[model samples]
Target: MTTGPSQQATFAGMPTPLYSGSPSRLLAWLDCPRRYRMQYLDRPRPAARAQRAHTSVGIATHNALRDFWDLPLAQRTPAGVAELVRSSWIDVGFRDPEQSAAWRLRVRDAVTDYLRRSDRERQPVGVERSVSLKTEQIAITGRVDRLDDRDGELVVVDYKTGRQVPTDDDARTSLPLALYAVASARMFRRACHRVELHHVPSGTVAVHEHTDDSLSRKVAEAESIAADLRRADAEFAQVGVESPRFEPRPSAICGWCDFRAHCPEGQRMGPEKSDWAGLEPAGYESAAAGTALP
Candidate 1:
């Protein structure tokens, strides 16, 4: 039997598939390829550690803020925010019920103060709205905490509950924020160049304005990361867990990594952080907003 064309040759000319992921996924690969593989590619997916107290606080605050916009305009008061926080509270990862209750009240007060600065009567263009961006090389998706229309221009707002008060540099350097801006602009068919990091705990707002060149640079950076991920993912498909591309990058972050239990190298870096440790002053990082994957 004579074959017209070999199967290998038939498929050899096909272009590599575009990588599909959220901004968080691209960052995961950069943070630790092994963790990314385990989190996203592992068929039986390793179980992550329990949520930390800070994450609970962040999620609850985000939830309350999201629901706050849904309330009747007259009910968007301090009392309403207090009630929302109470209802949205996640009572987990705390040392005890007393600690949880205390933090709950703290979050309530902080969120109330944060919203006080906003024009409650003017509804935001989007609240926790999901947005996406696509290029020839990759597809990225993420959710924006808030989207604002100021002077006919769209702005991306990301809420931060961490102790690290964001700065203009933080806003400018954030890959997720930049991606959200690009996605929001393309989705709404409007110009979006401004991004803000709102530190809800302290009610501090950090802003950055991106130029066309800057936004393009960010997209290129994402494409570069996605290209690397695509190769790693393909290698995983061929050899599974034995793929050499998935290597651990141990650092101080390993202490707080959710998959520390599963990564021997990460476990060796230091003692894993206690579930409630994040609520401690020393444990604060910029991760209080939680992961922004779709």
Candidate 2:
């Protein structure tokens, strides 16, 4: 006997569990199906190139920010931030030691300035907190950079170390931020409707206030993406690369594709960028941002 398309998706006795993914995973599919297949489904995944200096900077900045809250109140000073940056720095993926050291000092200052404007006296609700949001269709999990309680309302704050200073529209449209806000609210049993993108380099906070309807809409949007992923993932399991579901979507940003080394179609789009191509000063355009998968 043959099963219907829906029934074929089922295992011996029950339907498959809800799709598990992060906002990044969904975005990866939207960015390029071939990339999603490689990064998520392909066994013996292709090795991505060495990290860029800019990514190192971003990593260091995030680590320093996360560790800062753990320090004793008195040690949360600018000098302390410098110490954390030094301790958490990843020296890989740079032009040279000199370039690495220069960027290190710049990041130190950026974090220091950003923290100066923060209210150290008021402790945050959470830092680098892992939260999950689940619906009947999808189970989403991610780590939020920071969670704040302003006037008893929960806020989701995502730190951006990239060149672009995010705007209000970015905050409004961000799926990850919206999902985090929903998860934080549900986890803490508080109303969380505000999301802020804290652009660390420029110390700018782009804010957006989401309504209940808006958040619900975002979740529905996520569910839609997950449904597609569910089907593609199943197809990949059957035929792998032969799965027409995963297509190569190339663009000029091929220069920044970490998986470009494996994708002939992408390589044909443009020349690969230098390992340090994305290491420009934060004030400069984040080359990665140009083609950054939304």
Candidate 3:
């Protein structure tokens, strides 16, 4: 006897299992169901294009930041950061070698400047830390850029290298950041209610202090997202790409999406951006960091 799309997962007697993945996965599903299907459901996942220049920059910066704390306390200086950036640099998706090289130097300086204001000697509670939280319906996991124990309180820090310099409102309502804080608190047996978005290029930090009520709301929000994902996932399991639930959500950022190539709706929305379109603004570099790209 065959099963229907929703009922195919169980033996009709046992309890359903928890859904587990990084927070990015949940966000991806929420962001666009078609992209999510391509990214996570396809039997042979479609090949995504090579990383764009901005993503390359983000990755290099994140790697350098993650590796910084591994260096000796004496070597965790501006020079050290420069060295890390240079060594971790990814030369990809740039217009040419010259452009790639120029951005490399610019990113190195940005990292150096950002590190100058940081107390490099103080060891972080966790760097590039993997934390997870579970509820009856879902299990969410993600890696944090940095976890700080400031005066015995835990703080979640996420590094952003994109053109968007995070605002305080960005910190206050970030689902991933809130989930990370809650997971860190649970894993470390400490209270963690503060989340921060650290824009590396501009040396700007956006912070939000969460109360118990707010945290509960965020968790509930995640649960709601997960519920939608759960139903869609079940449908995908049975119908594959033919599932009606897996449809595209077109928006301005569709051009930036990794799976946009497979989406006709996305293609009609606008011309695709060049791989290197996000690396600079029209006139000044630093001032335009957060101006153009989404």
Extract clashing residue pairs from model 1. Answer: none
Answer with 1 or 2, whichever has the higher TM-score. Answer: 2
Tens digit per residue, CA lDDT, model 2, 46-112: 8988888779989999999999899998888877888999999999888899988878887877788
Instruction: State the C-alpha lDDT per candidate.
Output: 0.84, 0.86, 0.84
lDDT of 3: 0.84
Report residue 33 deviation for candidate 3 (angstroms).
0.8
User: Candidate 1 on 1-294: residue-level lDDT in tens?
Assistant: 111110112255576455678889989988999999889989799998888999999999999999999999888877788889999999989999998987887887777767777888778999999998989887788899999999999999999987678999999999999999999999999999999999887778999999989999999999999878877876787789898999999999999998888999999998988888777362222222222111
Global CA lDDT computed for model 1: 0.84
Q: By lDDT, is 1 or 2 better?
A: 2
Determine the C-alpha RMSD for candidate 3 after optimal superposition of all C-alphas. Answer: 4.7
What's the C-alpha lDDT at position 82 in model 2? Answer: 83
Q: Which residue runs of candidate 3 sit more than 4 Å off their true CA positions? A: 1-9, 282-294
When 2 and 3 are scored with lDDT, the better candidate is 2
Candidate 1 residue spans exceeding 4 A from truth: 1-15, 280-294
